[model samples]
Target: MQRNPISRRAEAIHPSAVAEMLAMGRKMEAEGIKVYRLVQGEPDFDVPENIREAAKRALDEGYTHYTPNQGMPILREAVADKLERVNRIKAKPESEIIITNGGTLGLYLAVMATVDPGDEVIVLAPYFGPYANMVSLAGGILVEIPMVKSGSHYSPDLDRLSEAVSPRTKVIMINTPSNPSGSVMTRAELLAIGEMACRHDLYIIADEVYERMVFDGHEHVSIASLSEEIKERTITVNSFSKTYAMTGMRLGYNVANPSITKAMSKIYQVSARCAAASTQIAGIEALRGPQTEVERMISRYAERRLMAYKRLSRIKGLHCCMPEGTFYYWLDMTSFGMNSWEIAKYILSEAHVLVTPGSYFGGAGDGFVRLSFATSEENLLAGIDALGDALSRLQPTSGRS
Candidate 1:
């Protein structure tokens, strides 16, 4: 019998839907077709001037070599300070935090460090697309608990979540100011989850990369800061990509207890060794630098959010709640009688606009689509205008009103 070359593990994972859509947009652009891309979650701004200057200074000062497998001590101190001041999570720079190649790597490391084969991981459905893949890569079964929708926001059903916990459960993965959905978990919700984790002796992987992108007076709470017992079991992952417009920098970190940090560092030392030395230097400045630029960027996003929401809500057969946080609007597209993939492809072909199919996130995302407002106001308006035109031609199969 001939053996297949690819491992089952490798074949089980789906290709990134965001990357595929981005590639399609690029291909269309190359063919002289204009494509208005709203598929990715990337901020379209440049790295803050101060942080860029810090990187250039590091290069001039001859800081090119890898400092340590864990990361530079100065950078860790800055991260610790930020955590304490902003997140209210008192993490020790010396033993609790380990810088990784990026937030994606930080999440992967946390899963690998804690989950064993056959262990079950509970995740909120319609989560960040990568969470499913990461759990699968760790040889864990992903058990999704769908968030209940109320008005325009999605929230965890605490009773359902509590019922889903089992003896085989090992980790509960959460993302806030969630990707795709843009629901920032409230403090009451965080406290309940933290208490639940303590009761079940489960590890909590909190992805707070979008912590700073909240809007409409919604607060971003770090679950680990709720209590000492909760903090002990939580491995909080964050990155510079979303917060500081440093996506290309590939810098992020994880804060966990000493034991979990040690396990993650062991994997990091062999795989990535360390993030770029200069990137680490820049991250220090991002944490400690003046906040005027950050404030300006977020303020701009708020204005774009309002503009996009007003435009999107006016379209026929579409329903969207104002996003509470993050830069995305999770749209209910079921009224058009098309699945997410069909809707996305139709928009791409007819309107020359790119959107992420909601089904890419999970089974719960089947009839929805996500639109990002991370680009300029002109692009945002133009893309939505084209989208509105495309959507107007469709006849509704279901009555949403």
Candidate 2:
């Protein structure tokens, strides 16, 4: 018998469902079928021209070398400034920030630095799919506290959250303006979670990548900004990917106290060293450049949001609430009497639309699917119409819709 060489840690981590769906869509397109892609978390917009120009100038200036492990000094200063102005969090550019290759790496570093073997990390259910795998890789146990869903909105329950905390709990991971669900954490919710963290003496890992895309007059709150004590316990990670359409540029940063920043830097130095020098220069421009393009993009997303809400409303068996933030609609497909993967597979085959299976997010998402409106208006109209048509053929077992 041949011996297996895969490490248990590597085996435990699953491939990202978003990536898997995108790959399947491409394979179908290769075989001559039109695949409507609504599965990825990436924005379909191009990088702003000014930011692109900055990168080009950096390359010409011979910035193709390794930067300090923390990142370029100018970019760090910009991030510090932005955190103060936009996020209301004060971070020292010199000691409290570290530039990461991307938001994903920044999140991984936070988990690696804080979680010890057997330490428990609490997270909200129906979370970003990668969070579980990150905790697994860090040898930390993941404890989920499901959010309370009322009609079209989701909120955290303070009583339930308090019940979930254990003596072994070391961290609470949070995402505001969340992906897939498009629910932005309210200021009141952040205050409650911050208070809980302070009481339990837990580290808070906050992901605020979708900060700029909030809508419906919803405010995005940085959990660290709730109080001075909360700020000391929080590790806030953000990226230029969604805001500036710089996903491919791979630039992100984290803000924490000097002690936590040092621990994350130890892993970052050996693993990634630093983000690309040219990319870091581009990030400086993204933060300091015009707000016109960013605002325009948000306006476009608002238009698409209305379109998606109207279309989803007309579908008989699917129930979805209008997203308050981000570019996704989380649809409850339980009426179809199918699991999330089954619903996703059926839609892909019948309507040629690729959507993310909600079960991939967590067990609480088993009967749902996430549809993204980050593509062109033409795609949104055609894809949702096709999805409604496909779902209409089935006789739903439940009357929830």
Candidate 3:
């Protein structure tokens, strides 16, 4: 008898590069290898006590029923208020916010709501890996525009971006305090992007999961905050996972115009229905409660960022940019004349350090690797030392400066 075949969509997707590295690490651990895990993006911190208490209280009060398709009204309002206060953008609580399982879901839903088959979605290169896959799953084509590197900063090449736009362009996805590179777009960049979206009538999906994780005195400017016209065309995606260290809770929301939010709500209703009731309550407390914990976490990340940059810079042939935000350091390894996968495998096998290969993000990410600093300071330092040792082995004759 013939076996059932998987859908084209499922077959077309490749295994996640981060997940592959994680599995490799786990396999090494099973063999008693001391693996220094710097691949995954999960924060090592615990959820704040206040938010945990809120979830516990909600459970105690039996608030486990299904909520509105959009989300709990109170949590929706809180999210809207957060936009107004933190992002300086106004959104209607009842119509503009829809909470999903996490920011990943929000991104998928936004794509589903806006993109059609063969539609073009421009994504910045060295972006989060899943963005391209998500676009493909949504039946859209991803157009990558590489960001130009200036010393440590990554800025959009507006000229190239302009050339990429066309009548078929439906969306432009952006991540601030970007995932792999940790580069934040400036206000001027945001304005230029907004103007392009407006000119092309393209929707903008702004993933700001690291909005609160900036370092070195760099500020995050939301594209939606640029103007009301831009806000209408932009869907701002965020999550409690990064900000509140509640990754497992899987609670996230999107802010957009009422029409777009309504469409996303329909998709949510048909698929997820609503996020966890208790988690939504937890999210409310996270947004409304004391923000000291968030501030403390940011400070710790900043310190780790500095430590990683200092140590990684000491590597013989590897060049890393000082990230302005997020907990990752993107390293250019082209000088070693090896692709990301080769370098990643070399490090994993020779040094027992697992990192994400940049090729997983897109074509332009071929010669880079991304290391996460979301672990303890001690572990980060140890991983950097291991990486340096591995680089020496790769280029034994290249003397260190």
Task: Give all candidate RMSDs, comma-separated.
Answer: 1.4, 1.1, 1.5
* Candidate 2 lDDT by residue in tens digits, 214-330: 998999999988899999999999999999989999999999999999999999988998999999999999999997888988899899999989989999989899888998999
Each model's lDDT: 0.92, 0.92, 0.91
Tell me the TM-score of model 1.
0.98
Please identify which of the two predictions, 1 or 2, would achieve the higher lDDT against the true structure. 1
- lDDT, model 3: 0.91
Ranking of all predicted structures according to TM-score, beginning with the best and ending with the worst: 2, 1, 3
Question: Between which residue pairs do clashes occur in model 1?
Answer: none
Instruction: Name the runs in model 3 displaced over 4 angstroms.
Output: 396-401
**Candidate 3: residue 183 Cα off by (Å):** 0.3
The segments of candidate 2 whose C-alpha lies over 4 angstroms from its true place after superposition are: 1-4
TM-score for all predictions? 0.98, 0.98, 0.98
Better of 2 and 3 by TM-score: 2
